[model samples]
Target chain A: MKTIKQISVFSENRPGKLEKVTKVLADNGINIRAITIASSEKFGVIKFLVDRTQAALDLLKQQGFTVAQNEIMAIEISDEPGGLHRLADLLARKKVNIENASGFVIEASKKAVILVEAADIEQAKSELQNEGLRFLSEEEIIQ
Target chain B: MFWDKKIETISRSGLERLQLKRLKSTLAGINKNVPFYKDKLKKLKIKPDKIRNLEEIRNLPFTTREDLRANYPYGLLAVSLDHVVRLHTSSGTTGKPKAILFSRKDIEQAADLIARCLVMTGMKKNEVFQNMMSYGMFTGGLVMHYGAEKVGLLVIPAGPGNTDRQISLMQDFKSNAIHITPSFALYLADVLEKKGVDPRKDLFLKRAYMGAEPYTEATRNKIEAIYGIDVYNSYGLSEMNGPGVAFECPEKNGMHIWEDNFLVELVDPKTNGPVPEGKEGELVLTTLCREAMPIIRYRTGDLTSIIPGKCRCGRTHRRVSRMTGRTDDMFIVRGVNIFPQQIERVLMAIQGVGRNYQITLDSLDDMTVKVEIRKELFDGKVDHLVNLQNTITEKLRDEIMVRPRVELLEPGALPPSEGKAKRVLDNRTL
Candidate 1:
């Protein structure tokens, strides 16, 4: 099973929190490949697919930021109307519940990748692979 | 092991006899020297000598904080200024602070009571004592210092804050005991963790005297676990010669109030009548030994109850439960009485909740509790964090009877712990 590390940082929902988080990453020269922020009224968790996962995690932690490295699968699909629908249908058939997801287009109208966080990552990965779906490796996602 | 073995283990009848004698003298002293009490007693036509039994104390007019404030700055002095060697004021957060004066004898008596408290807690001679409470007008520092010295312990008089210096002093001097607030103790635990210093291995601290603030038993357990030391609860107010009013014996069940020095009463806050036996109520105290300021039936505004049974230590003095909260500290939310300590009790018992929490009541009478989540507990899962929030909300609702909005914050988001933590922020207009 192939998986990529997604760095998630806990932040209080207040001004300058994002700036502080981004500043740490920018100073350490960690390039963010993809980003998603899920927030409630009082706080938020900022998840990032970064080029250098370990360095980013270490830098954020050293800067006193609460961070965690999560294993998630990123799968590419054709950038069309049925791109996400087909992936969702397949995961639904396999009973893989996506706990969290975020995506970005690699090429306009050509291809895109969806970051999938499921309850059981290894099971989800094997189930998806048995369905002939390929997951982007860490190097592939970073590139 | 006892400072005054005869006094500490006196029979109930003997203790009552001594208390009655001292009570009579205190009344006479105040009647002659303090015009305020003299006028009050004259209005009631109650003569000091006619008061034969302790139950007659109920006839005495209560001295309230307002009364103390009204008689501030020597208005209630039972002795002349020439005899008053010291003065300390209560931390008056509401209005004017109450002024408390002490003659040389009063100071010595206060120190003697403190010595009794310290020795009861198993503090010994030649032990290094680090005093971390503030000095100056705050009686917690100096009174405990004098008492520790009386016990022949080497007093450090460190006087709060300067955590780095405190740790170094503990390590270098091999201090065996300390006097500190519970909030500061939690902050010190954090500092020890950050410095990679194990208290059990790196320092020689044996016990901590935690007082000057009301803390939950859960907080005490947490501090005890972190420091690997016994945390004894001490109760006092500046109005009553702080930090020596009541102290826990080694059994740690409840604090024994020195009956020879104080007459204790537990009265309902609403009716000002005595609560049923062993029931919680406002603590009313009468000083039997204070020379410069002998307060009669002083309503302490602190809420506690008398433990029904005698302690295992066999002290004739009765024991009082830990202070649940002050009368003024209780807030009515949705017509239900709730204390900030209840919220703290719930929060401290949870696994991942941090030390600092604040309860904010808005004008709408709605409550919002802001809790700091431990940094290590943040596992990057929003669901886990949400579950924690729900757990806190449910536990708090179960404890307080009113559901509160619980906000999970990152560690260090709230104000840093310092001297006497303010846990409640009431914004209600009423």
Candidate 2:
């Protein structure tokens, strides 16, 4: 079972915060493989899949930023139409709630990877793999 | 280890005898020297000779903050203006600022009294003392400053609000003791950890004198554990010569009021009469030895009780428990009286609640308490977070007897303050 480390940063919903956060990771030579922002009216949480997970976590924490890291599942799927719908249908049948998710195309018009955060990561990973979906390793996601 | 053993260790009978003598002299001094007290005494048909015993103090009228405010600059002075040595004014965050006068003798005595308190708390003359309370008219700063100096400690008058400099000064001077407000102590603890200065390994702070605002005992324990220091609860107000009126001895049971310089009394705030011993009441005080402006029966709004037991330190001065709350600090929600300290006590006892919080009373029907959940406890699950919020609400309801809507805010969402942290906001129309 392979797992990818995802970093979540708690940030206030102020202008230019996202810029500052990306600047911290960029300056520290960490590449953001996938990213998403979950925001409310007053604040937001920025989720990132970075190449150097621990380094990015430490740098953000050293800058007085609240950061947390968790092991999440990253699956590579077909980039064709209904790619996400098929996976969603499979997880829905199994009642796997996707607490948070983000995806980006790795190979244009052919392949893509979806990062998922579920309440039970192991359960979701095993159920998705049993349905013949391919999972990406940490190194493969970084590459 | 005692600073003034003869005065501090006097027996109960001996203390009463001295109080009576000083009370007579003070009554005489005010009746003859100040026309305000003279007129009040004459109106009450009371004579200086009438106060022959300590029990007769009940006959005297209470001198309230309003009276102090009405007198303003010099109306309450018991001595001539030429003899007034120094002056310190209340912060006056609410109404007209009060001016407190101190003669040269008053200054020396206040320093001596505070020195005695420091010594009682296990502070020594050889240790380095850093004064972090604000200076300039805020009595907490200069009063403790003079007292630490008198105790023969190396004084670092590092005023509040510069956290890095405060830490560096402690490192530079190797300061072993500090005088600061309790809220600022919590803020400093946060800053110290952010700077990676583990107090146990990097600093030499062993003693802390915290007062000027009400704090829960849980707060005291948190500060002590964070820095590995003995944080003593200090009690005082500018009217009673600030920061030296009462302090905790080494036993940490309760703060011993130095009854030699000031006469302490506990009274029912509503009836303005004495309460039974060991009961919560308003703290009333009379300046016994003050020559410049000896206030009589000054009603301190702080609410506390006299602890029932004697201190193990052998000091004969009676001890007062930690101030629970101020009479003015209580707010009504659905006809239930709630104190901010009550909420604080409940929050501090919980595992995940952080130091900073805000209580906003929206109306009699709606009250909300905003707290910061510690970052470590934020598991990023909405249901888990809701459970934590419900737990806090239930705990607070159980403690304060009022159910308040609890909102869990992110870390650092609340405002940062170095002085008294404003914790309550009453947004009710009524």
Candidate 3:
């Protein structure tokens, strides 16, 4: 079972919030692989999968941004109509509650990888591996 | 026309003479009974009998809130507990509150002064007075109640809150006047508007005494327009016997400090020396008539100036302008004195709170404290952040005695101050 580290940055829901967060990462030469935002009325949390995970977390924290690092499992699925549906059905059957998720399609490989954050990440990794699913490692995601 | 016409209209020469004699007696009483004052006076090598004129008051040491808190419960009282008939406490900077002791004569004198204030504002015996200020340990309610009762007004002892009930009482009893805070009065006016109750037509309120908190003249005008009644400003602190320390007569000009009871001095907050006459400075007062506990040259922290010359109302007691600002970081929210340090203490004790925070006061007197969330505290869970916000709110409420809306912001969201940070943003017109 392989896992990738994801950095979550707490941000107030106001104008230029995302720009500030992204500017910090870009200024430090940290490339963001994938980004998603979970927001409420007053504030939001930005989840980022960057190439340099530890460096991004350290830099963000040093810049006085409220940031946290957590392990998330990124699973590769076939790039087709039922790709996400089939994976979702299996996770639903296996009782792997996905707390948050986001994905990006790779046109060259004709495959899509879904980033899954769950409380029981170890259990999800093992259960998905038992079903013969391919999971991306931190190095593979960075590449 | 006055509660104590002779005293209220005393000539400048006579008032000075009275103030000098009373100041001497106050010094003598505290010198003999209160060790705190006795020790302070002895260190200055001053005798009460040697104090001849009002100018000599500057020779006395200034008493501060810290001094009052250091003395605590009974340290400042000039008389014994057997002679003290009543006690009241107001919020202090720390956990311990400032206690004020009142002897039987002290209470009577307080009531008489309030009665004088009431009559000066045109309150009569037949008018129904609704006291909406808090009772119990807070002096606003009881002090105003005793005074209104002394004036023979049909006094209603309705404490603050329950806007519906307060309005209903005003309607049922035909309350002719009310003693309320400016913030609460605005809230009540909003409630009346929502209920489609026109105050002018549906109520019998002719005037209002708004005190215990600072407000602007524009706010007074707005409230007066809403209720169609004259809104008078009342100024007082518990140290100098609440709400009747100074009051506006029908002139609606600056409030006249009842010089017969309390000696008022305006001094530079930083220098502790008298500012030039009629200049804005911190208000320092001495309890000239109090028997049990006489605070001499007590620093009030409120910034105001003396309105030069006599008021057209014929009261010789000098007028002090409405408070401009505080010399310290203390702010009154919903009529509760709150120091930014009190909020900071609670935040600093908490585990996840960051160093920078700002207290914003809205026009309606609602306080919102925006605290920076520490980087380590963000665990990618909104529930955790919400819980942290609630915890800060509860702790601040316990410490400051006022519930504030706590906001968790990203670290560095608040503007970092270059040198001395402005921690408080008071948006209220006051």
Candidate 4:
């Protein structure tokens, strides 16, 4: 089953918006699976999924910041400069435009987060898998 | 305008005689007054006797835009600055305006040619001529003011932008003629209609002479429909003479070139050779009678054809077609050749956006120039702002071949100019 993961991103309301979110994931045992933020004029909704979403949400909620969990993707990508190119090329052949993406690669555990939106999410997943691309599930990044 | 030019467009036979005489005089003037020309003539071993007619006048070196720009301010003035009474210049976008100095006699002669053009466009002796072009330092207003007065017509130097008051003057004075740009005229007519004032019914306006910028046929129709007046196209430049180069007769087919006042040539801008008749080329002018700062073969950069067929007006003065467009103004925007006319056409077609947009080039972090369009607003509504911006951005991207960030602004927000309508706002070059 193709499952979308949700990771909790605890970001400071001030100077370090994205930096705070990245620092929280690096300190914890949880890996930032995938994330996206929907922002309004002022406050923003940081939506993401971690390997240990339940634990990350609990820890971030304890920090007293408005923490929320939302569905995203943590597709397992090869730790190469253009590994995403191979993944993106497959999606592009299926006519999918990546609006955002995020996650950590297992090869070097190079924890990176991205937010993406595509025209057809179902087609993008299927085409990537059929092209022998591996995807990190919600359970993979946390440990 | 040529009293100082001493150019009174004479008949062909008379022109031959005048050409021979001016040829001798010009050669003598060059030899005596101008050391550069004298040195050039000496280097060529050509004397005054060697130059006989207009053909030999061609043997002289052609002056270019570079020459004009280099010798700007008072450098090109043949006469002393104290003798020069009047001054005017164009708003050169690239650099400083080409300051033109006219002597007292130069002003009167220019006024005379403009007056003749006013009559050609059917201005009566006693009718009021409202000069709506910009006044002070710009030739459009001053030339029309002096020209109408010389022809025994009452003059109203109202200039432009005061639409409500100008309309009142037209109605109260029973003004018969108005001289302004076609774009402003259309804007005025639209204003009149919205204010529940019909120009033809609510006021008295007989004709309008429009120039200073090129416009389309559709614009002409709109202006005519709103004002219920004949709008004649007039062509001129500060370099050659202001406001009386050529004018369309009632037929509106083409403007009759005043052969007596000036000599016109259709030169291929690229090849610099004479273009065949009926073919469009850059209109090169030679003022037959300019004494102070006399310009020779000055290129207008306006694309047009010298149509040689006889007109029904029966003057036998050769006619030039109203300027079609320009070859110089074409610019490459993201590898797409964009003309202001194209953007204006699309803008006029769209009803929502006002006629006050400014295109700006902004630098992005990617080391590329991006176009940022500040959309002029018709009404102050946020909903409409988003919609119009989106629509215009899409349309402009499709037509102009580059994507632009469109931001809708409240009406009356763009910068205003007291002299010329500040339509083009380019900050990238700076």
Candidate 5:
């Protein structure tokens, strides 16, 4: 079963400040898989899914970066429109609630991987697979 | 020649040495023209050139924000208003808005300084830069916009708001950089996500230069990770030239001040004496480049320090640490100096009180403090609002010497902040 590791990297909203956070992950050879920023002009909350989830979390936390570990869903869907909607609808049908969803495409003409914080990960994955939705591997996201 | 001098090379040292000269000239000018300074300086028996170095400079009476208010519109300007090319005024906590003046040179210098800061953070020439800082009246937008333009970068004058247009420009023109407050940047990111567009992959943003309010390290990482770019810290005051006094270099550790253009002083906020290097003190600035209104030992009220060193980025000019806090931020809650941040720290510690909070002084009454906490109260299941409030009030009373009337507001009801969230409202009529 593939899983998504939501790695939180603490940073200030000033320039070159982000370099410190990304540098830690890059320095430790942890590859960033998917990233999306929830930020205001003054501050931001950066969420990342990396290759070595536990290592990245430990390193960032030890470095005094307030990193939190949360489980996110690694959902695979067809590369066409409404693919996301169908997968979400399937999860809803199974009563699997998505708290937040974000992801990136592997490449052109392939499935798009999404990282979702759902109420129930096992139920979500089971429902999606039952609905014929393809789940992506953690290796593919890091690649 | 100015560019060769590390102090003059977009860094802050050149500005500081230059401030000495400006401080002298401005003091002399003020003594000759401005009635208040003329009286004060003469009474203190301080002559123009004699007021040299830090010790002598301290003897000179400091300029305060209250002084600016007392002076009102024109009294603060050292040069005539005709020489003043523009004006930016924000309503202070006082009845009348505090006003600041800038000459053509002053504006150009500020813009040029900002331009250097832009390039320092990897802003390429002709890159389509979108300035989301508020335009007009607010100095943030125009100063940076001109600065980017001065550096020959393509500018998108997408002021503030108008989310659709900003998105369309990002999609169409492919903007490379943006200058906005951190909150607005997050908001734009949200809009981009809502539009089903990934900002990192689609947009060409290489930088998000943000400042105006203090933000946590968490915010910085979030902005950079989402946008996939560098975020630079820029610090300045409307009293001084806005947005270009000091800026963070590519090294990302601390901010370098353009010391040649502005004499930067770090004084014990209370004593008005120089604080030790690297020590936090009220940042008082002397503008060496302003033709319209050159301020001398003008207390910025904003707290920071003179880093005093050569930066790894090879800039010899001195740098200042990120603005830690402000001096006048102190609130006399029941006759004790209480910084809202102290209260905020306590409030954030409690799960019941959400982020947004307001502390107001009841004027018509006995000048009692009423704290309105707007939070995600329902999220906490401990029936803890009253207990949490009581705990906070007790902590505040112990720390700040005052009891607060804690009124809890529903989540998202307090005024949503686009810039620095105003945390306090002094309802007391002075």
Candidate 6:
């Protein structure tokens, strides 16, 4: 398993705010490998796994967006009916709390990568490793 | 202890009699000396002789800021330029500034009135007074300076800004009294706390005169708690010879208007007529004793109300409540008249809201407001933030009669203003 820097940006929950943030990252040639939005009534936190994490964070911060970085483990699991459940069950057994998480299939019908944000990411990783799980590296995700 | 006991404590009938005498003379003087007033009166078919009593003031037309700007430099001066000893001007945001002239006698009277307010606030000759307002054409600085000198106080003419020097002066010289605006006073309170100087012990600040802007009672309480001093509200304008027009006495209930100098009226701004007694409306004032530039029936554009009773301080002059906001500052959003003070009241009542906020009106297809929330409220809980926004939105709709978009910003994200806090930003061209 590999821990990647997941950048979370706080923005106004209004039209064009998301577009504005994405446009700034896109203009700077930052590729979004995986993205998920957790929104409330007034604001939204957009979590991103990008090809250039530091560049994306710096650019968004320069544009006056509140940005933060968190370490999360990205795992590649079998693209089966119980893929997410299996990962959740392992984390729960070890008393690891999942703060947030998102996943997508890179190779359809075979394998999928789920980005898991846990309270103690290292503990989550060690436990997952003890259970014989495989993680997608930064090189693999960018490619 | 009364500066002008005979005048200040006169009976209401006696005061009105004196006011009528001064009003008649002022009316005749302006009609004979100033062409603008002469023309305005002639067009309205009004004559100085027609004013039988003080109540006849209603027959005269109101003088607005537009009228003053149209005249520009010396259009409203009743006396010649050589006799005009000093001049002050309004900051004309939309057009030309209105120039106010003061004769030597007018300056002395103004100083005397300011000294009367000072004495009412317990300013003594033994105490050192520090003036912390801008000393240029703005009337707040020099007006208080002249009054402090008149009252025989050792006045330190410390102009505004430079908080370090101000704190040092207060510490070194044991300055017991100060004159400052409410906003600057709040900022200075923070600086003083950070410098580790306890205002109650390390410093000798006893009384403060706050004016030049409208502030809430909560803000006054905050400043008082920070400085451990008595804060008095001083109200005036350049057109009315500055900071002596009215003042709060020991009671601190309402500011007493100097009826001998200013004839005050509360009128419905839209209809230009009187409102019910003690009802809030636009303040309309007429200078009774001014010689150089006697503005008759001048509309101040400030919203306040006459207290309708005598102050407990034994001053016979009628008092007016603290000003809430300006008529010109009111903006119409979604066909609803909204005052910034209404929104401020709502925001201040809510917990976790910061002292600073900005209301921006944007016009894309329809007019919408964007309210910036403080950063401290963002505790990283997305659900809590959403609930807070929705609560504010619902409360704003209930309070201001309009729903606005809320955006939570980092602390100190909004731009800081130099002088007054720019509260509203209307980007709508229409």
Identify the leading candidate in terms of lDDT: 1
Model 6 chain B: lowest-lDDT 10 consecutive positions: B364-373
- Model 2 is docked with a DockQ of 0.26
Task: Specify the highest-TM-score model's number.
Answer: 1
For residues B65-110, write the lDDT of model 6, one tens digit per residue: 9989988888888988899888888884587888888899998999
Tens digits of per-residue lDDT for model 6, A8-108? 87776677878988999889888988888887655677888899988898897677666778787888888999988888887788888777788888889
Docking class of 4: incorrect
Itemize residue pairs with steric clashes in candidate 6: none
Off by over 4 Å in 4: A1-143, B1-13, B39-49, B80-83, B326-328, B345-419
lDDT of 6: 0.81
Q: Give the lowest summed-lDDT range of ten residues in model 3 chain B.
A: B412-421
Could you give the TM-score of chain B for each candidate, in order? 0.98, 0.98, 0.79, 0.81, 0.80, 0.92
Mark the regions of model 3 whose C-alpha exceeds 4 Å error after superposition: A1-143, B329-430
User: What is the DockQ score, from 0 to 1, of model 1?
Assistant: 0.73
lDDT of each: 0.89, 0.87, 0.85, 0.65, 0.70, 0.81
Native contacts, share recovered per candidate:
0.61, 0.07, 0.55, 0.00, 0.00, 0.27
Better of 3 and 5 by lDDT: 3
The predicted structure with the larger lDDT, 2 or 5, is 2
Tens-digit lDDT string for candidate 1 (B252-345): 9999998899999988888888887589999999999898888989899899989987778988799999999987888888888998889989
TM-score of chain A of 2: 0.91
